[model samples]
Target: MKALIISDSHGWTHELKTIIDRHRNQVDVIFHCGDSELSENDEALKGVNVVRGNCDFGDDFPEELIESVGGVTFFVAHGHHYNVKMTYVPLSYRAEEHQANVTCFGHSHVATAFMENEVLYINPGSIRLPRQHPQGTYCICEYDEKEISVTFFNTHGENIPELTVAFKRK
Candidate 1:
């Protein structure tokens, strides 16, 4: 299965819509790591799995979300509450506690993808206001029962190969 992962859009629904439309059928799942700022009433995210960002104030959202697709579990969070800008400690521990195969998050506005202790950690960066990196970016993860492969792409749709990672289940 292929999953599209994005974060920190911060209400740029139009951009999000365009990207989604471009990859609709190629992606089996859409994961939003947060900063959507838009209400649940926004129909652009009809089938997305979203977590509440620090900026998402409504009671309708949750701080974290865990989803199981194609027999793999994904733990997603917006990162602020996990102190992601400073360290990955709490977030890594949380992933361990949940026994999640992959953890996706955003808040640092810097893209990253890596595997440690058999768990994948991914941050797709900010789509609206990129920092550190020259361009805004998102990620696409392809996985099956045996392995997972992740590829990051900048706003211009070019693959950011340095941010890619592939893992084989132990």
Candidate 2:
């Protein structure tokens, strides 16, 4: 299965559309990790599984979403409630509670991916305002019964090799 994971667009509607468009034919699932600052019904958000971010106001969105797509269990969130800017400890527990194997989130605006406690945690970073990297970033993952591989890309659609990671599914 292939999934496009993005976060922290923070109001750059066109960029979001472009990114989705660029990978439209390549992914089976699309997850937006919030901070879009757009309404839940916005055209750009259509067909996307999104969670509420700190910047997203009102009760327009849920605090989190847990879904199974293409046989993969995903726990999606914006990470403020769990203090993602500090650590993934709290978020990990929540994912564990849901028995999720993949956890996707955004809040720290830093792109990272890792395997811990037999679960994969991914932060696609901020596609608008990024830190720790020169350009804003996002990620795509290819997975199956054996392994999961994630590759980060810049706004222009070029892959950031240094951020790409793959893990043997246990």
Q: Per-residue lDDT for 40-103 in model 2, tens only?
A: 8788887888899999998988899998988889999999999998889999999999999899
lDDT of each: 0.87, 0.93
The alpha-carbon deviation from the true structure for residue 26 of candidate 2, after best TM-score superposition, in angstroms, is: 1.2
- Assess candidate 2 and give its TM-score to the true structure: 0.97
Write candidate 1's Cα lDDT for 46-122 as tens digits. Answer: 67888889888886567898888877789999999899999999999999998998899998988888888988899
Off by more than 4 A, model 2? none
Please give me the total number of clashing residue pairs in predicted model 2: 0
- Give TM per candidate: 0.93, 0.97
Q: Relative to the unseen true structure, what is the C-alpha lDDT of residue 100 in candidate 1, on a scale of 0 to 100?
A: 91
Candidate 2: Cα lDDT at 101 = 82
Pairs of residues clashing in candidate 1: none
